[model samples]
Target: MKKIKLGNSGLEVGEISLGCMRISNLHKKDAGYVIENAMESGIDLFDHADIYGGGKSEEVFADAIDMSTSIREKMVLQTKCGIRDGFFDFSKEHILASVDGSLKRLHTDYIDILLLHRPDALVEPAEVAEAFTKLKASGKVRYFGVSNQNPMQIELLKKHLKEDLIVNQMQFSLMHTPMIDAGLNVNMQHDAAVVRDINTIEYARLNDMTVQAWSPFQYGMISGPFVGNEKFPNVNTKLQEIATKKGVTDSAIAIAWILRHPAKIQPIVGTMNPQRLTDIVKASDVELTRQEWYELYLAAGNELP
Candidate 1:
């Protein structure tokens, strides 16, 4: 697996990290098998969130890592907070309390990376800064980032916080690429939907913040799987065509399309099947040429002007 520096934090994480959301529901033996397979495949990063499986995900990870002492130092563990029932919370109390719970659940003294789950409408940057400071001072979290936040929202946090926010996790895939599409057709009024994210891909690179891709195969937000779904016949057809040419799985092509970008986005592969995790990690090795990359963009775009 390829490795990339996560922001300015100096922590190097695998280009493709394992997402642990589904592992909690799997049998304990099954969960252990999945994680162990990921490590053997050269994956050095794992992603988790507080709300995934109602905290069961962390427990499973805690057990899996505990089983292998040597592999623990080779992996990077990341998780999210700030998302509460019916709302978001970034206050000092919530941030502090959430980290404590995460540490306890993961059976670790510190996290490699910590992200704010989502944007809180009533966020107080000062309080968030305080929480980050406390965590850093006490060696609870080494790096910080945010999930599902826009450029302006991150800027707001930077204005009030002293810590370096290293990543912005967002929903991105070949089928749902408004962030990439919007920039390609900027200022084209006839195609109001053309402009999306307004160069968020560029913004992340400019700020030295790594972009983490979530729901990498979904057509939209929790809508449905687009991998082999007949609803997106054209998308799947195109995916297969490219996969055949690359000599890789259709799922690998789906992930490689994101890897082809210059922003260097890290995809969180949310696969619980051990074999599936191994298959997806090979995506890091699949390289798409400029022409092939644009082909995917055009196919995903509603209409090429």
Candidate 2:
């Protein structure tokens, strides 16, 4: 298992981390099995969220982890907060209370990384900074980051934040490449084609923040993944060709596409199947050539200018 330094924290984490959202209430037994397999395969970073299953996800994680001192010591557990009942909260009170709840549910003393789940429209940067400062001082959270946040939002927090923001979790994949696509389609007539984030990939890279790619295989927003789906024949066809050439499964090809970027993004894979997990890990080894990368992008409906 290859490890990369997480942002500027100097903490090295596995290249491929396990997304534990689907592990909790959705598939209890499968989640446990996948976690055990991740350990066996040397995956050390476990990702979670407070609202993944209405706090039930963390509860099950506590049960699944089940008091294994040795295992806990070797792994880095990360979770996100701020997303509440159809709203976002980044208040000092909420942040503090949320971390306490997460600690109790995960059955751990301190979280390795805590992310503001999303950008709260009504966030007070100073309040968030205070909460993070207190948490670090008291040993509740080791590091902090944000999810689905633009550069401006992160900059606001950074202004008041004492701890260095380490990671930014976002929706990124080969098929749904808006971060890449918008730039390619910039100045087009359509509003949807306009560039968003103003180059978030470049922003994170320049700011020394790690980009965590969630839903790494999805075809688009809220749509199912494109793997083996006839709806995206071109996407699957290209994936098949690349997989055949690399002698790896198509899932690994999809992962390799994201890993090939210069941003050093970490993929949070959501598969519970051990074989699928193993296959995705193979992406770390299969280096996609520049031509192969462009070919796959073209197949996904993005025309090169």
Candidate 3:
């Protein structure tokens, strides 16, 4: 897998990383298979969240792999906080306690990257800054970021945060293109013209922040993956045609479409199936031409004004 510097953090990581949200459902040996396959495919970064499976995913990961200092030194562990049972918490107390829990579960000394899972309407920038400062000073987290946040929200945090937010995790894929849609529509008169994300991709690029695309294969928030779904036949057919021509799986073509963008967005694949992970990793080697990229876009029910 090819490596890219994560935002402005100066940390090099694989273009494709593994998301460990569902690992809690797998057996220890099976979880080992997933982590082993990911490492074999050159995926050095593993993404996690404090609330995923009630924080069991992180525990499963540490259980499946030898997280000794020597082994952990080679891989990057990134996890998110600020999410609770029924509410979001970015308070200094919550942030510190959450990191302690994650460190214990993941069997690690420090998190390679820590992201505020989501925006807390009641968030106090100073409190967040204090949490980050303490975390940095304690050597519990090396870098910081925010997820599902707008440019303005990020700027608000950046104003008080001494450390640069190196990454911004957002959901982007062939099916979910709202982030890209608003930009393409411009002043056109249509539903797509509504800017839902305030040009997040453009904002991240200008500020030197890396946009990490999560859920790269899903059709919608709860519509499940579109790879072979009968309802989205047009996009699936197009994906297959491109995959056949490129000698890779249709999922690989879908992932390649995201990687084709100039912003260098990273696609986090959450598949636990070893075979599927291998198929998705093939995306790193496939480069989609401009025409092919637009073809997949149009096939996915997007219109160009």
Candidate 4:
């Protein structure tokens, strides 16, 4: 597996990470299988969210893994907070409380990275900064970041934050390309030209914030993945075509497409099956040419200006 630094944070992580959302569905024994496979596959980063599986995912992870001091030193654990039972909360109290909950559940004294899961419309940057300051001072969190946030939101928080927001988690895939769409459609008259999220990917690149692409295989928010969905015939066909040439599964090709970007985006895949995790890790070995990268993008029904 290939390793890349998360911006200039000087923290090194695998090119591909394992998202632990669905692993919550696995039994303790089964979850152990997934964790073992992930380590063997060189996926040292395990991404989680407090709200995922009602926080059962983190609890299960702590319970399933060996958790020896030696093993714990080799793993990087990242989790997100801020979304509550109904509304989003980034208040100082909420942020502190959320990190405590995550640390308790993960059985770790410190979190490698903590992200605000989603932007809280009522966010007070000062309050968030206060929370971060306390957490960092207490040695509860070593790094900080944001998820599903635009450039302006990041700047607002960064203005008050002493810690560098080294990572931004956003949904991007061959199927979900809004982050890429706006940039390519600049100066065009198409619907794709309609700006959304203010092209946050470019901001991350400019600011030295690593972009972590979640749902790397999903079609979109509500709809399921496009792998076998008849609604997206072209993309599935193209994935298989490239997978055949590379001698890997179509899913690996899908992930390879995300890793092919110049931004060095890390694709967070949420596959629970042990063998599936192994296959996805192989994407680190598959390289896509520029032509092939755009081919998969267009195959997903995105139009260029």
| TM-score of every prediction relative to native | 0.95, 0.95, 0.99, 0.98
Model 2 quality (TM-score): 0.95
**What lDDT score is found at residue 8 in candidate 4?**
78
lDDT tens digits, residues 1-305, model 3? 98888989999999999999999999999999999999999999999999999999999999999678987988999999999989999999999999999999999989999999999999999999999999999999999999999999999998899999999999999999989998999999899999999889999999889999999988788479999989999999999999999999999999999999989998999999999999889999998999999999999999999
Highest lDDT, which number?
3
Of 1 and 3, the candidate ranking higher by lDDT: 3
lDDT ranking of the models:
3, 4, 2, 1
Q: Tens digit of lDDT per residue, candidate 2, span 82-170?
A: 98887889999999999999999988899999999989999999999899999999998999999999998899889998899999999
What range of 10 consecutive residues in model 3 has the weakest lDDT sum?
Answer: 216-225
Clashing pairs in 1: 182-195, 182-196
- The regions of model 1 sitting more than 4 angstroms off are 67-69, 191-198
Off by over 4 Å in 3: none
Which candidate number maximizes TM-score? 3
Better of 1 and 3 by TM-score: 3
Cα error of candidate 4 at position 257, Å: 0.5
**Least lDDT summed over 10 consecutive residues: which range in candidate 2?**
23-32
Give each prediction's root-mean-square deviation over alpha carbons: 1.5, 1.6, 0.7, 0.9
Which candidate model has the greater lDDT, 1 or 4?
4
